[model samples]
Target: MLYRMVTPEHICPFGLKSLDLLHRQGFDVEDHQFKSRAETDAFMASEHVDTTPQIFIAGNRVGGYDDLRRYFHQPVADPNATSYQPVVAVFATALAMALAGTWATTGTLISVRSGEWFVAFSMCILAILKLQNLETFSNMFLGYDLFAQRVVRYAYVYPFGEAVSGVLMIAGGLFKWIAIPIALFIGGIGAISVFKAVYIDRRELKCACVGGSSKVPLGFVSLTENLMMVGMATWMAVR
Candidate 1:
């Protein structure tokens, strides 16, 4: 088999490892570093290469990185040999549930306030808990300011908005004047969150859902998980 390895600048550890591993496997590999898209195009034209890490086993184009991984690791007849499970869906669902539950419970508690002082006390407790979680998420995804800025922004803003919405929902449920608008607004934010999850997944971006037990990747399954949350939130609001 002849392997024509085309790669961008060695910017990540994974790229370097891939190159080394391919060479050690005793394939007739040619390495080309392309600094720009134009260079890549020219190289591809000259070599009749149609993809990165193009593997030709007896003059047949196998595919890209993922394909190469499967070819080397799995049997030729196993259709599902290369498939791997991703943790994104589970993580996204858990986080969304925790956030939504906090909102629902706090709102319910506020609606059934025992006294003036108790309402203030309960709100204060809820605010502190929400803020702490938000800050944790911000630090996890934002890394004090380099990448995943959107995740950080969402983390910081979402909790505060939830708190405010919770309060409004509670007030509305008790007084019967503000319930519909507040619920609608909360539902809107949930829908927006679902959209954001989808965008991140389609872009193959990393998620910044922080904390000791929350490490998840952004992927298609995660986006679907968020959509479930969106459906629930919308239903809750309407009810």
Candidate 2:
């Protein structure tokens, strides 16, 4: 038996998770859903419980989602654990898109332009993530970014600059004069900032590269991103 809240306003996510788990474990579950907050609260009060999605197997209470996971010997996620998943996902997607687009347009996957497209695509995607919530990204960026800390407004303008640089770079280097400088300036400053915060200052902080809410550690990945921009800019300038 499984008792979970399924109100009109909000369906409890853990309840769905619990149901899926039970099914996967080959258990036939009798679902008992509370359709309103009042009923859920009253049941909770009567049972001396604090949360929903309570599971019962063969008349034995298996508790909530995490508790059920333990019963099944499954690993539970740590909320505070540092994860590179988001950044990896973004970069991987960008690389795939860059390769696919290059092949579709040029009839080949390997070319000098392939690398350029990869970096440009990465920049645009990263900028899009940061631009989703400028205020949040700005606040988090100010924590360790030297330029943003000093200028304040630079944090907000940073994403737009990245987007512009990326778009111009993708336009076949025709606007190299404009794109190169922006990429160099932003990338140079970012590299230094990340280096100081992570290597020199020995500060442990979250990266704002993906977004403010991401838990990506402020270190190598961030530095590499900046370095890619700098290298791309320098190459474009000289070529």
Candidate 3:
């Protein structure tokens, strides 16, 4: 048996996916839906479950969609899978955009200008993701940032600093003066923090570079992010 939810304003996507999965897995499903919010709440309360798309297999409570997946021996979309895939995807998109921009401007991807553009865009995107939920990012950041550990408020400020300076770096004028110094200071701090946390201290931590929801580890990938900022800042300062 399956109990799912659908509403006028929003339908649970997982509920639909659950039904599909059950059908594919050759389960005989007695599907049911919550006709209204009150009924949904009552059902959830009665079942003592927080979410819908719940399943019962042979009269045994199989739980939610993810739980059902586990029952079927399928890999659930677990975020803490400790893969660099998220950062890789973000960086790959940035690289593709950078190459396209370079080609558009100079008819080649080898343009001197494209390097900074790539760096700036990457930093900005990372910052935006972090800024989406400042509290969450700050908490994750405090796990490793040397200064943020000592001074908690620095965690809150870091993402905004990255975002504003990254945008300034892209603009490239008097703003470069502001952007360059900030990047160097922050990046230098970050690189050291990541190195000490992952290498020296041997801590297992999630990176806040791509934001709080990211499960990217505190290792070479995170160190590279900081190092890239430092390199970009140095180049901008000298040029």
Candidate 4:
């Protein structure tokens, strides 16, 4: 019996745990890590395999992780019984970005009468929290190998950007024109980041958004979020 495991670096906790269980079961297992999706698909095609963690018992494909787990347990007849859903952490990220954009854009409209200072302070705090969430996501997606160098730089930049935008938001309450452009710039960057996460990266891993619910895709929600920012930026730029 040959147990083959194919997983991306730093993204497959369940797969790893399954592999460990297999090892304890005395099966000959070989683990392979792929950097990109193309490599993984090519290897799977060559091996005549369909799913990840493909197990071959005397050269017969047994199935994937769930299959193996069921085989070992044997309370169930089918080896391939499991519910493995793709993690959706992007929605939370989109929500955070959307909130930041809304807060920045509407700062001028919020009156200075009743709890305005508190509201501005809350926006600042939320902006910082959102920035922290983005930093966590950067670390997760880039991994430790490249995160320290590349991710950290962006991490620092984004929080500072958030701070600047927060200040501009406060200022907008006093002088609308001054803060509008600054808020637009910050929101524009946020939109770009969301676009990259959704259209470019395809939300394969978990997003590290700070607040709100986690586990949602970056496709519709992120694209919409970014579009809102872009629209806000364009409006501010024109005005």
Compose the digit string of candidate 3's lDDT tens values, residues 1-239: 98988889668898899999999998888889887889899999998988887888989998998898899899888654887887887788877877888898789986777777788888888888899999899989999999889989999999888888878877864578788888888899999999999999999999888888787877898899899999998987777
> Ten consecutive residues with minimal summed lDDT in candidate 1?
111-120
Each prediction's Cα lDDT score?
Answer: 0.45, 0.94, 0.86, 0.49
- Candidate 1 regions with alpha-carbon error over 4 angstroms: 1-31, 55-62, 73-239
- Badly placed stretches (over 4 Å) of model 3 are 22-31, 37-51, 55-63, 70-73
Worst 10 residues of 3 by lDDT: 169-178
Superposed by TM-score, candidate 4 places the C-alpha of residue 148 at a distance from the truth, in angstroms, of: 11
| lDDT (tens digit, per residue) of candidate 1 on 1-239 | 33333345434343344566567777656554555666656757877767554555556666655566676894343543322222433344434444455456675433223232232223323344446666555564343222235444655664454445446543534432343343345335444543564464344334432221243444443344334333433444555
Model 2 C-alpha lDDT per residue in residues 3-56, reported as the tens digit of each score:
999988999999999999999999998999999999999988987889998988
For model 3, the local distance difference test gives: 0.86
Per-residue alpha-carbon lDDT of model 4 for 113-197, expressed as tens digits?
2132333333455455556566454554343112224445664454454456446544544444654555465456555665566
TM-score of each: 0.30, 0.96, 0.81, 0.36
> Which regions in candidate 2 have their CA more than 4 angstroms from the true location?
none
